[model samples]
Target: MRITTLAKNYFFYCVLILTLFGQNGFVYSQCPTVTNTAQSFCDTQSPTIASLQAVDNGGGIKWYATATSNTQLTNSTVLINGEDYFVDDNTGNCGPRQSVTVTIYSAPTGANFQGVCVTSLSQATPSNPQFVINGNNLQWYTTPNGGTALSPTAILTDNTIYYISQTNPDTGCQTSRLSVFVNVGLVPTPLGSAVQEFCNIPGSPPTVGDLVASGNNNWYLTSAFGIPLDLSTPLVNGQFYYATTVDPPCESSIRLEVLVNLYEPNDAGSNGNRSICVNEIATTIPFDLFNLLGGTPDNTGVWSGPILTTNGFQGTLDVSTMTLLGSPYVFTYTVSSALCANDTSTVTITILGLPTATVSVSPTPSCSGSPATFTFTGTPNATVTYNINGGANQTITLNGTGTATLTGTYTANTTVNIVSVAS
Candidate 1:
């Protein structure tokens, strides 16, 4: 809101004080006195006769655009910006006519200049200026009313304010210089936490933001979350380098955090190295088994050992060797990741505990003539067998989840024995 002005000094009409009081109202050879005055207004507005001080002190008043023009201004008049006008009295003894200068001021306003500091002068000049001069003839200066002209939007690496001037060309009036505080703040210092990777090229000096001190950025290796790493700190797998911005002393909020991106390899369980039950895979194994340890994902598996079969995480388990290998069976496979060369995971097979077998008979009493139903409960995916009075053994596969049932016709219920075997 700072303003510079060119103002006209005020003058008291000395002639009016003397002649109006005199007893002899003489139309003598006294000069109709005129006071030299200054005129100023914005280019958007017009000037008036009273504003220009165009009235005579001798009591005879008439305003004209020119010294000799007949177009008399009986009332108010709108004078052009920065244009001139003359006023005189022809009815009374008058003196030399006086000329008034019209001054059209250029309103050079400094708008809110909030911007990021740039590295170069060219970068400082924005597409749109922060300050605006209302007039067409606009000029920019480094110093107040000094130096060569510059663009209004220019930004400097250092924090400083630039001066600007606006001119009213129509009235030939130039306003005093106004200022636009070009708050050229260096892009908030890039802190180490802002980076995702770190090549650790010391002295080569990677650019980073200094969140602690403004306009100064430092490079540093950081922890997984971006905290600066200690000097000579050993880089860890799947870690990160951070880059953050320093807060300016005046502006506390100018801050930023970014990742440098480059720390590779995941930690311990990153590969597929977890255990799975052998019996759980009736038709296909769980897909997440590949990432049991941690992985690069998109991996494949090769079944080996007594099963001697090839498969994937979702492939069927080897039930044939369940009897020999028994429950809690162990197996291994190498699951690799993508992109990077060294991404292998761990996936193992574990046969779960076998469920016991239980038999339930419907129509328990001697059936007389109807067929009796024998229901067997066992581990999912296991085989169930039953003997009816030692007549013969009937085998049926468990529902792979629940119970298995068997039906036989007998005049009287002799005996029902059931057995369950799990792989």
Candidate 2:
């Protein structure tokens, strides 16, 4: 009975030993529990096998490329996408190890681009080139690897290679960089003077063809991008036009600003003729010579006629300083300009002299308050005016003999005077 009991206790002890240590007589610990069984990483991260181990617990760890492989892999060994990796404790007695699947994200695709150098004043910048990519959250960089992302408004170098990258919005995993070549074309030379001036004639106005330029010129109404204009388009005064050169498929991005100015020709109006009595010359007010002009004349023209005073665009005639009466004076008005020929007109002013008159009293020694006769001699069939005792005036007409008489009732100490003798 004692031997049987000792045998049963030994058999139970062996079973317990077998359960504590492994079948190979080595102590056993739990295999590492991979917190993340399925892992995803960007190719740019360069994940490795050691990245799969989650728990250490001071037991150390080992990585294998396959699930059923005895060969161990170093921490420096790179990981592949869609492949399973096995991880276990360094004890080497665990029954089964944890497995992990790695997923590597590739770089986004991008296409090459072309650009042009746009020049303005003394500065130049790239224009008309765009970077196209296939993924979300795209970014541009100067180097192929890690670097600061470029700004959207950053200027690109000509004929250079730029790197681009994209990121997954859900996973936040960024892909590797892709190269894009930018081929920038050369800028073409400009044509002619910026501003031009031409005369605006009545029958023929200035046109776009009249502009002075030399090249394969393409004219535009606006300074920026716009449709080209025809050569027959009429040029407005003080308007601006743009010009560019067409060098095959590549045109100049910088446009030459051409300002057009149409100048109106100077005008001197038609001739004028007038006559005025010398006695009435003092009463004649100063007048502008422009009123005598027949057609519409430009006010900027200078007046050159007799001795005239000018006030800005107007000329005043001075009729007070006239030595000769009953004579015709011709005043020539000329308008001159630098761009147009001179124009001239004439104004003939004639002054008339006062008529001569001789007065005689008839029926001498007449009584007071009696009718008296006054005789006047003047030009043939001329009219004369006389006043008695400073009373109201009376008129008298001369016949063919150039003589006339006026009768009036006079008061005591009456006086007779001829007011005017005119024909």
Candidate 3:
């Protein structure tokens, strides 16, 4: 029984020693190993509590603002810049905890850009940075995160979203939270000008052409005041046309204006014909070309005839000196419209010569002694017929004296009838 009691006591003392040694082993182990390093973050970034925990990472962690403190850090605690944090792995109050530095910096900020245009993507470049946020270092990039670096003097040539960062010149750190959007503007290129013609006829519809703009460019028409015109279909004539170029995703546009002229097509008046007497041209009646041919007051015409007929723009023509006592004569009067290439309408004037007739009898009623003479007067060398004593008609031709004489004997109460006709 004495040996059994001594063995049991020895075993209890050994277990007690082992338990005390085990508990103090980690507590006194070389001031809790810690290898914390400095970290930087954006002011807008929400850091997790785990971020505040030391890399030493063992046992219950405690954080403090000073080297020694009774207050502990909750998981919901927020971290800030220029703040010193102390960490400890021990479960109770202790000294010598790991330390981590926290830094908070601001991201770059700027407004959107516009009116940058280019033909290709390779030529794209960002304009000078307009940083709304100020920092130690300024830098631009092609993307929101990481991409090609852009120079401060880079010329923006196309539509793009460029990223910029503001480093805390003190810390040499930057963030890519801010961006500036640039747009490509339309090119102000004129399609050129041309003339279009339509006759005075009807059934003319609105006109439009696709040559105004190239592929992928939408074409639109507008008035001088920049009022939008119909684009679902064709365009109209006689209207001042202005071609406005529009490109998508671009807040700006360019204009190419073209002029359109509408005029009345030339359709000369119908050919005119009229009769006139010799030396009887002057008339009170005035000829109005506008009322005569339904043309504008600006119509012009030329009269070509004998005696150097007057050729003037006047509507009425004086045919007095243009005609003479002769056979049918032709006087051409050509008139042109304002819109015609030349005058294609002509007016003809015809004149007739005067005819004369006369009758005379000599040695009146001499009974069978001598043949009574009957005379007929008419145009030179004209033919005249006279009937005597109701007998068969006798015909005679006027000689150079413009008179025709017929000889006949009176049988009983002589009766004669004389008439003249032009040859």
Candidate 4:
């Protein structure tokens, strides 16, 4: 019985020792916990096998190309993007290997560029994108690589080659330099006087092409930055225009201001037609021909046509000397100017003859205290004034047939005479 008990205790002791330390006879712990299973890096960083080991929380990390491979990778071995690597820890004992994936991102690329004018380069702004490239965090450089970035307010030199690059914000990777050949052009100078004058026309007005300029001129409504005006743009009087000389894509930065002046001369007034009585002509004073002209005529105009006794251009007509009564005479006034055509207007005047009448008395042999009737005949619709024996004068209006009558109780043998008549 004693021998059997000792044998059972020895068996239990061996089983306990086997359970405490596995068949390798060493204490074991759980497989190394991968704190970061996947890693990312930029190509510029150039990660290596040692870089993967640095992240292992448990020390003594070993790296391999494949999960099942026994061959180990050296610490200096370079890592590749999108490749799987295996890592395990042997700090206390060997642990199950864990798979790791490395992702290496490439740098940003540069975009296309074009030539610009020197003036544009000098006045470039963020809104005015003269120099352009395609990427994030774009930077301009003097050299192809490893140089200080050009400042935003840097003064760019003309006819110089510039390098450009961009950096990736995600991985902090910078791209390779791209060559930008800057072809800076010079602005052309303008020549000629600023002020220009033109004559005013009725239908067709002056255009931009009509203005005098020295070289290949481009016109604009504004002095600065705007599209060139077409040659057909009508010029306005007292308005200003800008002129520039163009050198292909480049134009003069300083514009020449052109003040447009359109001039027009005064013209003769409108025509006039008038009538005058022959009796009043003898007492009429000589009057200016300008007074006869209608509208607002210039006083310096010359007069022509009929009935000018003196001074000709500015003279008046002497109606008393005119023999032909009831005749129409037309007088013309002409105005002239330096750059404008002559303007002419006419005035017509007609003279009317005096009216005539004959009187007859009814009951010519009437006795005293008897009523008397005096009848008159003259031109159609003529007015007459008469007196009975030089007494109070009486007036009467004639009928359409130029006949009128006066009734009065006059003394016997009284004489009645017609004083005046009019039509």
**Could you give candidate 3's per-residue lDDT for residues 43-153 as a string of tens digits?**
545654556635443465667776777677776788877787777765635456767788777675556554444443334444333234455477777777767667756
Predictions in order: lDDT: 0.51, 0.72, 0.57, 0.72
How much does candidate 1 score in TM-score? 0.31
TM-score of each: 0.31, 0.41, 0.40, 0.41
Pairs of colliding residues, candidate 3: none
Residue 305 of model 4, lDDT score: 72
Global lDDT of model 4: 0.72
RMSD of each: 20.6, 16.2, 13.0, 15.1
lDDT of 4 at 294: 76
Give me the displacement of residue 250 in model 3, in angstroms: 4.1
- Candidate 1 shows a clash count of 52
